[model samples]
Target: MAYLTQPDYVKYICSCGQLKPITSLYFCRHCLKIRCGFCICHEVDSHYCANCLENMPSSEARLKKNRCTSCFDCPSCFHTLSIRATLVQPRQASTEASGDAKVENKQAKKMYYLSCFNCRWTSRDVGIPDQPVASGGWPERTNPFTTRMNQLLEYYKAIALQEKQEKLERERKKFAIRGKYITLTDKTGLTGAMARNIAGLPSTDGGSSSAIANFVASQASEEVEELPEDVYTKEVNLKQITSMAQRLASPEWQPAEVSRLHPLAKLLSVKRSQRCRACDHNLTKPEYNPGSIKFKIELLAYYHVPEVKIISHESMKPGEKAALLVKLTNPTGHEMTIKLLQPEDVPIVEEEEQKSIEKSLEKSLNLEKDSYSWRAICRPASYSALCRVREVTRDFTLAQRDDAAEYDDDARHDADDVIVWRKSNKLALRLEVETEASAASGAPARAALALQYSYRNTVPPAGNQPHQRNHTLYTTVLLDLGHVI
Candidate 1:
């Protein structure tokens, strides 16, 4: 079991050399390897508003600047703003003729405004008119430099396109070979520029050249504006002035005064899926519905990998042996035969299998030879040199997990020195740790161990071949012992 405040006692080594708890690791069924965040690919699946639970397409979200149109955040405290409604008497059409009439006869109208309960801030505080509808009628403030910003954006986009075209042309020239016969288009005087124009695309140089020529650069001014004479002598009112955080919340117009602040549009949240970089197989994918927190596919390591937890350990002294108790739980449904070995004694990947994995990765992901994923797969497991695993020659079998067996009090006790106790699929073992003689006092004590276990492949066979039930796999773990006395 892991605690929030306590440090991790046992950590598994990922394929990419990262040490993480099993809860934070992922198992790729296709690759049959343990992967961490550094060795996987993340992709955004969808965007939605957390407040309204409203989903929007990628194009729509981009157009709206990745913010929810209906939902807003408070400018004062940066909290989600709630819509508040008020009933107000409507103005009389002919107030002069009905001056003697009672105002109670007039009909009342419902109006809505944004309110922040946390900070007690309201839209009326900034002189914003109440909306007739409860949602989505709030007035939007436009940036005064919107036109200039658009021009700058267009100019940069054109420059990027021009650079990309030039790069492609250079690469083509380097790889192209002279042809004896000319194409029909080339013979008919239909150049690439004309073809692009015919396809409704901008001409190669004309569009970018024109944009670059039309761009206007801002000039620096020599004159400086003078501040008010009472600027330093005036008594400051902090309540009226906005703080840096409040002003920066809206980057377009950073309001210096509290009265100039407005409700900010709430940013959109994304639902992303993770995929194994080597196999291109999805590790986890969430449901499309914004309201559902469940995932459609989740291949977490907790379900497939055996979990090892440090139950208790004795204090360690230099060049002395200490007793360690570790609990191992088989999470899989199939019975597993586990053997503990030294970290260095773990078997290396066979040449044939390694070549096959490389080929598969190349076919699936089109990865380069020097890519990070390829390197991680080819690299060997790394462990600290200060720690060594005491060899345990015994092999134990753990029964398949049974949910009903957890309630039973009967636990089969094996008459072995290593096996302490055994339940349904969990067992506790007593192991001895020999500290290095050169280990210094007050230094961290760590022990490295490797597990070779049998795993049952539940996925269906690709062809008409029979199911391959069991396969052997290896994993290494590091245990943190208390500091040496």
Candidate 2:
């Protein structure tokens, strides 16, 4: 079994100079380059409640402060509160008071209250009443400073609007230029207010625009409320008080005592989609359903790039070459021809080629012209030091992956000195690694390797040019050998 927490023995160098494991990288087919988390754009797709599996639109989510109405969290233990039902006996009138003998009838009413399964905390702990319905009939607390908060919000909004108008006027004055041709409005001497008056339309200026209310500035009072005498004289119980986290969870009241803590509305979770900044293609996108773990598009580097794992290596000494064994697995459906070379031996992508690739990405900035946050995508090339490997050693071929190949009996194989063993899509190799003579004892044993492999581009015939598939791609990886003995 793969260990959940293990140090990375093999790491690949990404196009943007990042060294990451195969699992943490993404492949952009449009740009034919590897991208990491730092080079991708994240966007929120939907908001949802994990426990209730209730989905909400973005607007509704914002209006509700990103909380689920029917679900709640335990204010004591912060666990999901489950609804418990109980039978409540109704009150009945006595026959002696009515002066008539009668058969009294009453039915038990079922009531629901929130309880935490972990902490054994119920609504009765905080003196909350049980509800007749199982969900969404609980009374909500009203904030004492709601009026002040609204006034502050309106004041800030109006200030922002005033600042925005002033900035627009400044920008207009700075960039203003005379047009070559005179407009009919300018030549006919018709101003905006004059035109509005002539057309019998209301002028969109001052109070005529909308009902702009004047915000009352809050006043500071000199007198302070006296604290309870028990706060200073009486012994305090920490168990009956709320912690900082519990208080901040409900910011409106921020109750300091346990009795004031109420069942908190569950915060909503979001499903986000990731896109490659350079190619403008989706790297990973989840399904719209909150319960689904599947993705609509997942271009993980592990699926596109070959995986290399260090098996074993002979103990290394200064100035001596050590024998290293590594296993390579082709995760693709097609057979791959891989050659080991020094990093410098890899082909350098020309400037013209890079420009052509960017041109092929063909992202139009026109669509984002009005977007305030939009900016041109700029992808930086990988910065790497050439590996010191001596020679090519030799090239080898790995067979295509076959699920049924695992069931078949061991097949006949040719004996090769370089290849240690051969399986369905995996091959093991014995290679040499050299350590520097002047290297100190317990120094790190490191080696950089470049792999030249034939890749088949699956860029379909979508926009332009015929689909030309065959291409040779190059990747550089760094290996961490055991420390020199």
Q: Estimate TM-scores for all models.
A: 0.88, 0.83
Which ranges in model 2 have alpha carbons more than 4 Å from their true place?
96-103, 162-177, 180-234, 347-390, 406-414
Judge candidate 2 against the unseen true structure and give its global Cα lDDT, from 0 to 1: 0.78
Report the lDDT tens digits of candidate 1 across residue range 82-163.
Answer: 9999999876654344457443467798999889999999999989999999868788888999999999998999899888
Residue 444, model 1: Cα distance from true site in angstroms: 0.9
Candidate 2 lDDT tens digits, 1-485: 56877788788887656788888999887777877776566779999999999999999999998999999999888999999999999887557546877757699999999999999989988889999999798988888898888767666766667677779668655765566224565555676768888999977454322324665555899999999878789988999889999998888988989888899999999999987766677889999999999999998989878888899987777888878888888887888989998776777655564353354334544334322222233333344321144565668898888998978767545576668888898888878777778777887777888888777787685788688787778898888886777
Please give the lDDT score at residue 159 for candidate 2: 66
The Cα error of candidate 1 at residue 65, in Å, is 0.7
Q: What is the lDDT of residue 62 in candidate 1?
A: 99
Candidate 1 achieves a global lDDT of 0.85
